[model samples]
Target: MTTRARATVTVSWPEANTRRLARQHLAAPAPSASASASPAEAVGAMLGAHAQVLSAAELSVGLRGDGLTRTDVRAALWAEGTGESGRTTLVKTFGPRGTVHLLPVADLSLWTGALSAVPTGPNLFSKDARMTPDQVEAVVAAVGDALQGVELTVDELSDEVVARTGPWAGDLVMPAFQTMWPRWRQVLHLAGHRGALAYAPNRGRKATYTNPGCTPMPGPAALAALVERYLYAYGPATPAHFARWLAAPKRWAAEQFASSAASGAIEEVEFADEGSAWVVAGDTDFPDEPARGVRLLPYFDAFTIASHPRERLFPGTAYERALGGGQAGNYPVLLVDGTVAGVWHQRRSGRRIAVTVEPLKPLPAPRLRDLEEQVERVAAIMEGTAELTVGTVTVGPHA
Candidate 1:
């Protein structure tokens, strides 16, 4: 029997960036203006938008989708208008890396099943407060039972959990996000990953939780599905990238990659500057040229976070100016020719948004014009008038 060798494609850094721009819908004349006609399709395109900062997530979708407004994003999230058609088709949940994200409701099962399949190390609370595997399962079940067709705040759900599962679930308090959370609340994170819980519309300023009706796939199958999706959206990547993106252990990510490779679900490719990486099988198509135009991407934009080879994406001084100390989401980014060229911030004053661009180097007249157009687009999405200001780059405390 003859074995056929897989074709090896050597991709240049420029070519890779071009492909990323087009695939991510940032290319000039932007691919299929209709690709983002709705929030669900836009979120689905990027796999899911980073939503730790809710407003940024709204901008993430608004910038991608045609004629989408902040109100439209809200409508999709809170289901504000009509019957089934009035309700938002997206769900807010703790997704990749245990961070909050907005995912298409239809894909919740896949996200949950794949995320729950990973074994997150030991409990970080006291031994007495730590939940045994069986106890954790019970807590998850209690969460599902408690949240069925009802919305409850984290505090309220904690009470229900203790009632259903016992006091151990409430005895542990863990430090998180500058506040103390019940040790059992960790299960809530797992519940999100297991398709058992999702975020509901906030009650005033307080957040509420609800149950998403989904039956998650088993671990291995879910993992495969996640790997395929990751490759499709951000591939020509390495196991380390996948691990970092998902906050999964390196060993597990490597195992998944190996399994996928063996099954021919993905193929190994040599990427420029980054060497060996994996791309989805038969996903070798590249655009004829690099994307043109400037974009003011909000904090934690998928393109800013998903792209690998940080050096290429944030070349030279851009590394420090746009992503100081290897941290992202501290500041909004300025993308020029598919690379991080600067960082920006917006200040709003009654019906007006002033966007200040701090470029690493002076932009040409043409690029400045493009930047102006981007600013206008942002203002329109924000439903406010906008003004552009250029200033010396300064990293903020957040940066």
Candidate 2:
């Protein structure tokens, strides 16, 4: 006998975007001085900000939290702990997709513990440059220990790591930006995901590494909770979408979603065209009004990267014009009414900024005014004042 399928709620793309934007603080900006939220908490609301280009990450967070400045974002990440346990409120480290992200220090346990579950990939380094599993283990241990009580520059960390492990750990064989990095550095993501190392504040021109000095919750529980959080933040999504976002294997992600659904932690729903997807068990409500606003998003913003159903999010010519060959976050976006309305670029000098926007369609006076205000806010996020220009943005991605 065949078992009956569970009832699934259907949601329109407009409704879905509305619900997601609300959850993400993109539907309406929260007053920064509401006495209810801090920058760290803002970062937490978005899960984490993609920080590969740290300045862009700052804009992503600052814009979501009205009145917040880039300085506020940095201070939240770099502030010293005043309480008995001296963990900074925010940490910059490897997060989802194995990319650098700014995560709240308090949630490091969840992120590290969850990320540790992502399966390791085969090494692509030259045979001689590769370290054996045993050697990798030794290097990871040494890197963690060397970082416990102090921060170390890559060069200094290299020396200690080599002394603690062996010369093999120091071999500059792993190729990087036209150069080779030490073999042991290959495990940097692994180290961060395991709660071993985190980024300390930059020292002069060099960045330093330090022990996170936090414990990761155990893997199984953390991984489950992570899936729940993702569903809450970006759900009505298939396991395939989740896999792509997490950089996890598709089969493994399928199992995770299945387990969550089986456990009643998430429920399946029918979302536009993607067939069935998952959302948090009780989070099916959506707003009647569409998400309406004018917002400027920075490169590699979390919203652009993680939201799904590409056709719906991209809409019209955005699929060809604004997107970088269909990938989100390569070019900064101009979002209006919860969809990609255009692309924008910013150039800053000293205390001034010039922002240019290219719209897919003509912006009415009201939207244009909103765009100017959005540009002003973005400049404030950069700690500058901006002049807005409505025309072609000739610069290429990340320019």
Candidate 3:
């Protein structure tokens, strides 16, 4: 048998920054267009928007497209999208990283299929709180059937699930927020991953669940596709980085890459000074120019959360200042010339938004002007005027 040579490309860290920014639609100005992109469309490209904080998620999507506002984002998500079929274009659910996200309806097939197959490592719940594989499937099926035409609050859904599965499913086993959660509720994200249900709108401060009406494509193929998507969006990455991003087992992630390499599903790159990384086969057009600009990324922004080479992304004092114990997305960051240069905070008052930036290092006069422009852009996205202040951000992480 003859082995083939995998096409390899050389990329410096600076070049990697350029390609990543362009892929994420942050390298240049938001393009002026006759038809504005829908929030779903914008989010679908980035995979999905981290919606742990719904307002922050809205801003995350609002900043990426041509003239999208918080109002537009909210409307697209809540006005029509419910767990039921044909409710909306976007469905709020448990997506990548097993956190809340706004996934596009059109791509739910891929999302659900891919997410269901991610290896679940280290079960966190007590033995009593955990569900057997068979029990989880039963709950997923019952949840899917119960949510077909009606939305249910968390309590209501719990009742329905327990009624269908009997008392063992309702045993309190998992600890959360100073309380124990039922065994059935432990699989809420699993249900979402299986196309059984998704998060519905809050019913007066209480979260609800509904059917997303999706059919999951669960198989090795689906998982492979997700790897491809990740590479396209955040490529030149290693299995270790991919594992961390998806919260999958490290060995399993490496197996996926190793098999893909053998099958030519992915190509290897000699990322300069960063060792070897992989890109989707045929995705080799790495930009030569370095990414340079100023941007304001809110808490849990995908760029900072999912991208790799963390040391490069959060260089110098940024690692200690912005990250929380080596975890990204705790503090909103200031991006200058494609790396974290500072931290910032924003306060909204009526039609005005006040922004305060604390630079880790001295920013040039031109960079300051660029940052001012970014502040104005953020204000526009929030439908207000922005005032820029280069003072200290008094608040702490996740504040």
Estimated TM-score for each candidate: 0.93, 0.95, 0.93
RMSD value for candidate 2: 2.0
Better of 1 and 2 by TM-score: 2
lDDT of candidate 2 over 347-366, digit per residue (tens): 88888898889999999999
Clashes of 3: 2
What lDDT does model 2 reach? 0.85
Candidate 3 lDDT tens digits, 1-399: 987564458878888777887777777556456434578877876778999888788888887788888887877777643345444677899998889999888889998998898888777776656778899889889889889878899789889989998888788877889998788888888888888888877888988888977888866778888888888888888999889988888899999888888788899888866688898988888776777789899999888987878989999899999999999999989998889989999888899888999999888999888988899889988899999999889999877
lDDT of 1 by residue, 1-399 (tens): 966464489777787888877666667654355565588877877778888788788888888877777888888888876456636789899888788999998888888888888869656677655778898899999999999999999899999999998877887467788977776787778899888899998999999999988889887998998898888878789999888888778998999998998898999788887778888999988776776789888988888787888888899998887785786667899999888999998877888998889888899999999999899988888889998999964548343
In candidate 2, position 305 carries an lDDT of 85
- In candidate 1, residue 177 scores what lDDT? 85
Q: Residue 243 in model 1: shift from native, Å? A: 0.9
